[model samples]
Target chain A: MSVVLSIQGLTKAYKPGVPVLKGIDLDFDERGLTAIIGSSGTGKSTLVRIINRLVDPGDGTIVFKGEDLSRIHGRQLRELRRRIGMVFQEYNLVERLSVMENLLCGRLGYLSPLKAWLRRFPQEDIEHAYQLLDVIGLSNFANQRADSLSGGQRQRVGIARALMQRPELLLADEPTSSLDPKTSVEIMELLKSQGEDNKIPVLVNMHDVELAKRFADRIVGMTGGRVVFDGLPSRLTDDHLKLIYGGEGWLQ
Target chain B: MSSASIPAARPFESSLGAKLLALFILAYACYALGQLDFSWPRFVKGIDNGARFLDRMFPPSFKNWDQLLTGFIESMQIAVLATFFGVLISLPIAILGARNLMPSWATWPARLIVTLCRAFNPVIVAIIFIKAVGFGALAGVLALVMGSIGFVGKLFMEAIEEISMKQIEAIRATGAPFASVVAFGVLPQVMGRLVGFCTYQLDANLRNSTMVGIVGAGGIGGTLFAAFQRFEYDFVLAILITIIAVVLLGELLANYVKRIFNGES
Candidate 1:
């Protein structure tokens, strides 16, 4: 399989002395699901954010396709980001916008200001949005405001929005963290199927070990801002869990 | 638990400086009243003069109804036109003034423009505009536009600033252009409040537009001032009544506009 994304020596620090991501490296391939499992505050979300450049890195190199992400800025950065879809833990839908509008938000980068202000999206884009609505099983909620949707339904719209980008790589920053166990599994399944159907690599940050094991072909365990384990889920043992979670008591 | 286990209270004391300041203000008021010659005899005579003024203001004369209608209508036009122009201009100013969107250098200048517009009273601005434009309703409209920009623009900027950046980040991450980010991320959150502010500014301009005419900036106020100068107190009273009626109508119109855009309604 072709390498979809490559990261080398990625480091970020809000303050000079305390670093969040301290010299990290990663490589993602163009198929299946890869889950990043780690304890709370292990910089998992920051890693995904840096991949999308939502939060800029202090020092690093992210080569997605052939372009170096860290060196891009302005319109180039925007274009790169559009091709890489992202899903947030909180859904992050524009609450005031209608469900249909929220789904089409992914196309904003492709439309002109005049077209966006007038809400005159291309006909094909609108059709795809409607189709995605059915795909996500929320066809009846096209006109309803996003704030009126349940957490699960909103997250579904969130997924549809990311899919609207027709992304090469999908980055989900703890997408199931706000959901219940059943809902979390359902979302993971939805993500897994979407990745397979689209033939795109899905990188998910997760806390649930069993869910990750069930869905991920390979699991990357992170601890203290560095990758501690990178292998098939079958190889992630109790010893590896201890190293990733930083405690023996919680492993039980 | 024993009943006598309570702690003793501390004594409360007032500051001597506060008491002395109060006494000084009281003495100053008395001295100022004396200087103004506000005696019992003068007050009684002033009431007699007020009675004469009220008597002349009775049965408000509508003999100059044509002039009253024209002046009042002009004032209404000035107010509506000024408010429309002001709100149109303020949209961009508000965007520029948002701290999250613009750098400090840009926001500072945008804020300074709003502050300068707000610093002067509409009447004072009318006087200056009247001098610049050589009188008439044009000057009144211009003055009120400045007033509208200052008040409405500042309010719109603050509303924009208060929007959730999380929504903006989500939109930006989708690879939206800066303009698209504003339309999708920024505008939806602030749209309802912007409409409310625009309507409010319109109502305020309607009120100020009447007074701007007194400075020869053109409105019913010019005619009202002439009536006062000529001792036609009844005619002045008619203009005042008309202004009150127009202002009430404007308030009703503003509320209707707000309702139309509320979406919930």
Candidate 2:
């Protein structure tokens, strides 16, 4: 598979001496969902955010589609961002806006502020938003306010919003953490299926090891700001889990 | 655990300083009353004068009906124009002053401007505007606009700051421009509160519009002040009643607007 994004010598430190991501190097393929599994506070969220330039990196070269993402700013950065879609853990839909409007938010990069303010989204975008609502099985909820939706429904809208961008890359930051077990699986399934259907690479940060193993083609385990294991999920054994998470008490 | 060794429970803590302060306030008030020569005889005479004043104010005459109508129209015009311009100007200033949205360089100047606007009361501002604009409805409009900016700008900036950053982050991650981010992410969160602030400012401007006219800024207060100066007590009474009615009507309208914006039928 062709590599869609490559990270080289990535390092980040929030404080002067304390580093969150310590010299990370990885690449994402153009297809399949790859899950990064780790315990809390292991820089999983930071890694995901850094990829989208949400959190500035201390030092590194993030090469995506023949461009150095770390160096871009202003219009260039926005242009790069439009090509990448991120699903937040909180399903951060604008709560007071309708579901249809929230989905249209994904198209804000292409529309002028005046047009967006006037809510004059193009016909194609409106149609695509309607299609996405259907795909997420919320066709009847297009006019409903985002705050009124259930957590799972909101997450579905979040995913649909991301897909509205027709992004080349999809990044999810613990998209299932706030969800119940059953809903988590459903979200994962939707993410995987959507990724496959769109022909876009998916990089997901998750703590649920079983869900990751089940949905991901490949799993990368991280701990202490470094990747300790990278391989197919079938090959990720108890020993690897012990090394990545540390301690065996929770293994039982 | 003997009863003798157990400390008595003091649930209500009283401060000696508080009692001393209260005593000092009462003593100062009594001293001040004495200094002002506030005795029973003085109070009785004041009450007698007030009764005579009330008697003169009865049978309110609307003989100056044309003058009263013109003043009312002018005041309403001033209020509407002030609110319109105030809201228009405050939106950008509030956005600039929002620390979360703008850099420190932008917020500092914007905040300073808002503070300056709020530093003077509407009457004081009216005086300044009258000096500059030469005594008309324009002065009243300009003064109340400043008041509106001070009130709405500060509250709107606070409202912007209090919005959920997560929503903004999501929008930014979509690669949306700053304006689009504000349009979609920020505006929706604060729109309802903004409407509420605007309606309240309109209500305030309506009241202030009348007062600004007293300073030759051109509203009903000009006519009312003239009547008072001439001891046209009945005319003054009529103006006061009309003012009260107008204010009540403005309040009812403001509430209706607020309700509509709040999505209430």
Candidate 3:
């Protein structure tokens, strides 16, 4: 019901004169799935990354949990990050580590470096990891190396690893882009259900318009870094799609 | 028409300068050989002496078994100790040297230290350390530690450089501390490769330990050198056999270490 993450006039430009995110403004609620849908090079991924501060915004105010994330640095920034979780397009699980170990890595911010290095995780954290693995349907594969899993299974581990943080907010950058259609739907469903179950906002950047419509409670469409559409999925019409993607031939 | 059929060809002949350079190198090699008096007679005489020496090396005698045993054990100790400390020290130094991980200023100092350590051959390093530490396993250990930093440190830095930056970015996004970032992101990607480097360095240190002793650094090689000076060829043969056996045993142990760390293995 309340704003969990508030972004106001967020801007990013890799080159001084060439701005990638011209000026963006959006607010994320504390529950349900919010899909960021846009065509390629529209700065959807950039917007998500800026939210997590993986890519620094040129100028913006990102106020999350009453703290301005853009202004924070050092230990304060790291502490802020512990409350937020992020997933990647490529899954990005440490390939050499076991699923159990990779899941525990979500708690890396909470553990001492010496303890993490020694794999001396707290019993509660280990129990929570196992519970998360079970939730993600990867209980039997906990001891298996991440690289040994299939695309969908690896993404499951990726999700479980993020959930291990017990984060207040979740950001997934194209979580199902590499998967097959059936697997993509399954991953989307998992993400949607988990977001609802945890009562946390999950902001996902996706190119699959149909998949986004199917799962998103609210759809935010962008073009050239500006919000073009912000409403329920049912309200996203052909006119909105034309504006979000540009040109009518692709839709046909 | 296919793209392959396009004619963009040229003559594949060497330029005049290249031909003359080749000719000059051949001439210089011939002149150098001539100055060195590398004739068939000299080669034949050398072969005859080699044959006589080979004849003397046969039928190895373990006349002083107790002394040989003590020397062999010391060689093993020197190898194990040097390898353990060398790999231990190289881990953090290698991380600091990685160009991708650290700034150029930091990498330069780390790289320079590794280069200087590797610049001297272990035998030369052993000679210097023997002078400093007064002739024992301590000198042998120090020399091999330099060797380990030279080899494992550089190799470990290379391994760190080759890792996927995308993985690191994902971890950093979590807002993990610097140390946590290394433990979760950097170490996982490089751990298997680091294990491989350490075991190979250990095997190399095992072989070099024998040679360091010849500089009076306390190992089986010192005993073998003394036997050669005294014309105790049979005792020397015994020491050589012991060295070969030790090197092979170290190789097997290194393989086991690799297996334990390699996920698939």
DockQ of all predictions against the true structure, Cα-based: 0.85, 0.88, 0.63
lDDT of 3 by residue, A1-252 (tens): 888899998889988998889888888888989999998898999898887777788897999978889877788877888788998999998887899988888888788878877879999999999999889888899899888999999999888888989989999999999999999999998898999899899999999999999999999999987899999999999999999999889888
Per-residue error for A103 in candidate 2, Å, reads: 0.9
Residues B1-265 of candidate 3 have per-residue lDDT tens digits of 6757967756696899999999999999999999999999999999999888878988898888888998888988888898899888888898899998889999999999999988999999999998898999899999999998899988988999999988787677666677877888898898888889878987998899889989899888888888999988888888889888878988899888887777453
C-alpha lDDT values of all predictions: 0.92, 0.94, 0.88
Q: Candidate 2's residue-wise lDDT over A21-110, tens digit each?
A: 998999988999999999999999999999989999989899998889997899999999999999999999999999999999999988
Which scores better on DockQ, 2 or 3?
2
Per-residue CA lDDT of candidate 1, range B84-164, in tens? Answer: 999999989989999999999889999999999999999999999988988999999999999999999999999999998
Model 2 alpha-carbon miss at residue B115, Å: 1.2
- Report how far residue A63 has shifted in candidate 3, in Å: 1.1
What TM value does the first chain of each candidate achieve? 0.98, 0.99, 0.98
**Which pairs clash inside model 2?**
none
Which residue pairs come into collision in candidate 3?
none
Provide TM-scores for the models: 0.96, 0.95, 0.92
* lDDT of model 3 at position A16: 91
Complex DockQ, candidate 3: 0.63
lDDT of 1 by residue, A129-246 (tens): 9999998999999999999999999899999999999999999999999999899998999999999999999999999999999999999999999999999999999999999997
Docking class of 1: high
